[model samples]
Target: MLAVAWAASGDSHEVRLCVTDKRLVWLRDDAIADRVRALRLAEVDEVVARTGRVRRQGELRVRARTRRRRLRFGEIAPGPLRELAEALAQVLPAGAVRLPAA
Candidate 1:
C-alpha cells in the first residue's frame, strides 16, 4: 500500500508498506529510481485499519515507537483494504489487529 510515514518529530515521507513472512516493511518510493525498504515489520508496534463513511473510505495505520505509516482510500478500494487488513493481521501478533466491520 502507498502511504506516508509521519514521525513524532514532525517529519513525513512517502512510503510503501510491504509485508513479508518475517515482518512488515516500509519502502521509500517517491519518484526515485529504485524502491528501498526503510523499515521492517519488527518495527511495527501497533496496526489498525479503520473504515469511515460506509466502508468506502478507509484509513490504515501501522505505527512504531515514534513513527506511523498511513494508507488512505484515495487509490484503494474496499476489497484491497480487506485483503491488506487480513494480511496485516496475519503478520502482526495475535489480537493486535482490528479490521473494520463487514
Candidate 2:
C-alpha cells in the first residue's frame, strides 16, 4: 500500500493506493466528510482520456473538519496520473486496463 498526501494551494488532499486481489484500489478524501471513497480505475481512465490528460481526481470524500463541505478539485500532473493508471492496469483483469498513453 502506498499513501500520498499533499496540500495544494492551502487545501489538503490524500491519496492511497492499495493492492487488493492483485488490483490497485485508490482511496481519497471524500471532501464531504472525514470518510474516504474508492474510485473505479475505469472511470478515472475515462476522465483522464476525455480531459486530454489526468486532472485532479476530484473530491473523494467529505472532510470532517470542514462540516461536510466539499473540497475543490486540485491539479495533478499528467505524468503521475498516467503512472497511477499503469499501476492500476497491472491489477485489473487482462484487457480491462486501458491506459491513456496506450
**How many steric overlaps are in each model, in order?**
1, 10
Which stretches of model 1 miss by more than 4 angstroms? 1-17, 26-30, 66-75
lDDT of each: 0.56, 0.38
Per-residue lDDT over 1-102 for candidate 2, one digit per residue giving the tens place of the 0 to 100 score: 332322232233454534343333444554556444344443332222111434433222212232334323334344554554455456544654444543
How many clashes does the backbone of model 2 have? 10
What does the lDDT come to for candidate 1?
0.56
In model 2, where do residues sit more than 4 Å from their true spots?
2-34, 39-74
TM-score of each: 0.61, 0.41
| Residue 80, candidate 2: alpha-carbon lDDT | 50
Worst 10 residues of 2 by lDDT: 42-51
| Candidate 1, poorest ten consecutive residues by summed lDDT | 3-12
Clashing pairs in 2: 29-61, 30-60, 30-61, 30-62, 31-61, 31-62, 32-61, 32-62, 33-62, 33-63
